[model samples]
Target: MPVKATREQRVGWHAAHKAACGCRDIPASLRPDVIKLLRSRRKP
Candidate 1:
């Protein structure tokens, strides 16, 4: 991850990491936003 990643970048990296490696989860701070993003993408 970048040393000074933006909120979106941080969330995206964590999301991808969560998918590729089930070792860790996105931080609590970012979890809600990540879920919101995922839900939005699933919409028609």
Candidate 2:
């Protein structure tokens, strides 16, 4: 067996990515549109 990272590491990466993308001021009103755009551009 080996030492391993838990879900927090993965979750943290996404949080960091969002921060880097400057989503800090995303308004509640635009969340749905943002989500839709992200969903439309789903990863491979």
Candidate 3:
């Protein structure tokens, strides 16, 4: 089985993802849909 990620790893991943996407603060209009899309694609 795969190991679970630690809190620090999660935080680092979010930071890196935001930096790479250049969307640290997604706008209000797109926030909901964007988050939904992201969650839908999240790997288990």
Residue 5 lDDT (model 3): 66
Pick by lDDT: which candidate is best? 1
Q: Which candidate is the best by TM-score?
A: 1
Model 3 lDDT per residue over 1-44, tens place: 11696644544455446547855675565556556656766799
Model 2 lDDT at residue 7: 45
lDDT of residue 3 for candidate 3: 62
Rank order by lDDT, top first? 1, 3, 2
Clash counts for the predictions, in order: 0, 0, 0
Question: Which digits, one per residue and each the tens of the lDDT, describe model 2 over residues 1-44?
Answer: 12474544434444445546964654465555555555665678
Ranking by TM-score: 1, 3, 2
Per-candidate alpha-carbon RMSD to the true structure: 2.1, 11.9, 12.0
Q: Count clashing residue pairs in model 1.
A: 0
Q: After superposition, how far is residue 39 of candidate 2 from its true place, in Å?
A: 1.3
